[model samples]
Target: MPKIVDREERRREVVEAVFRVVARGGIQQATLQNVAAEAGLAVGSVRHYFESHPELLTAAAREMVHRVEARVRAQRERLGPDDDPHDVAEEIAGQFLPLDAARADETAVWLEFAVAARTDPALGPIAVELHDGLRTVAGRLLHRLGVDDPVATEHLAAVLDGLALNAALHPDRLRPDAVRAVLRRHLAQLPGGR
Candidate 1:
């Protein structure tokens, strides 16, 4: 008899292995063999889902995006559009911060992969695409908030990224409310945000 496989589920498992490898040893060490061991599968098993290491890294980046988008969507759904602006902003940005164990793990993995992206030619494009996609999402959110300023959406996205990075490094420096306050201040600085 032959074994059966759920292709999608197996792929997700492999992507998760990539995350674990990154979190434990950084992306530089997340070779196919490491990922296979992290996933508790044979190298061929992992390769069955991803044709190569580059493919695995790219998939991991995409998986990170999916994780973020899923969290944001769920948070937005729970808060609804009527939530306070500060609360809404906090919730959205919180998705990126390592405020909890799960998020901390994700942050570690993401940072490792990001560092690898800088020098790994194969992963560079994946990182760029992820960065651009997130920026677009943030820009659209700013546009929806009526922040069509001189610099436009790009500025808004940049601000979000800056805040997220800062919050991740020094949570004590910015607190959730502080993050919201900064965002509110930015909005108030806009032409008619007040």
Candidate 2:
């Protein structure tokens, strides 16, 4: 009898390998060979899961988006009726910041994918979909905090994006505490801020 392999699990392993490559050397370095080596598998095995580099990259990007969306939803669920609106806003926004090692890896890979999407037509749609989803979440956060102005929602999204990028790229300078402070300060300026 032959052993059975979990196809989805194998695919996830390959996708995670791509993330490791992207985190270390950007999307350009995340070749099938590199990913295979990272995943401790043969290039042929990697190809068995994904036919092409674009297919692998797209799968990795989709996984990243899925993980981030799940994290955001978890943060939203943590909100309580008695929680201060300002604190709630800061907590939700902080979900995107690189506050720890795992989050830093995810953010780094996401940043790489965003840049690669600019040139890779196949990745462009996934990148745009992630962006729009994030914007909608930000809009909802603003509305929950009583910020009714459309301009304010847009500005908040930009601020969150900038903060996440800076924190991911310069974790030493923009440490977790610093990232939290920046988000808290920004939330303090909102309409219902304390």
Candidate 3:
């Protein structure tokens, strides 16, 4: 029998190729040819999965968001019942930072997509969705800490974004240890922090 192809898995592979291209270079370099080469497939194969560049970009962005959310949820589930609320908040917020190699790659790709979304109409909505999702996470953390301020949630979201951007771009300067320390300190200073 002829080999069967997993279309959904193949599409995920193509999306991962796009992420590799963007993470290695930038969004500008994530062309169909480069992505195909990265995935060890022909350009025609890539086209078979995604008809156009915009569709591929959108898929890659969505995949990155999905990965980030999965990681965050997993981390949240690992928390102990007796863990301090502030510590829990810190751990949850740390999920957004580039503390490890996989997270660093995801952060790099996410930042590229967010920047490109500024002018790309197709990517703008994805970017907004990502922003809102992060803010909602921040709000939950704030509520857990007994704070109920929308502005505080927004500020925390911005802080997390800045920290992730800095850690992703300058890992040498802002090491994971430093990022954790900064995040712990920030969480400690929150209104209801212990």
User: What are the models' TM-scores?
Assistant: 0.78, 0.96, 0.96
Model 1 regions lying over 4 Å from their true place = 150-156, 166-194
Better of 2 and 3 by TM-score: 3
lDDT of 3 by residue, 1-194 (tens): 99889999999999989988999999999999999999999999999999999999999999988987997899789997688988888888988889998889989999999999999999999999999999999999999888999999998998899999999888999999999988888888888665
Candidate 2 vs candidate 3: the lDDT winner is 3
Assess the local accuracy of residue 149 in candidate 1 as a C-alpha lDDT between 0 and 100.
55
Clashes of 1: 0
What C-alpha lDDT, on a 0 to 100 scale, does residue 171 get in candidate 3?
91
Put down candidate 2 lDDT per residue, 67-120, tens digits, no spaces: 888888888788887887777778777777788888899889989989988998
Task: Identify the runs in model 2 with alpha carbons over 4 angstroms from their true place.
Answer: none
Tens digit of lDDT per residue, candidate 1, span 1-194?
89998999999998988888776677788899999998899999988889988889889887887898899889878887676654565567567656676776677777776778888887787678767876666665656566655475666666666776676567778665776677667655654456
- By lDDT, rank the candidates, best first: 3, 2, 1
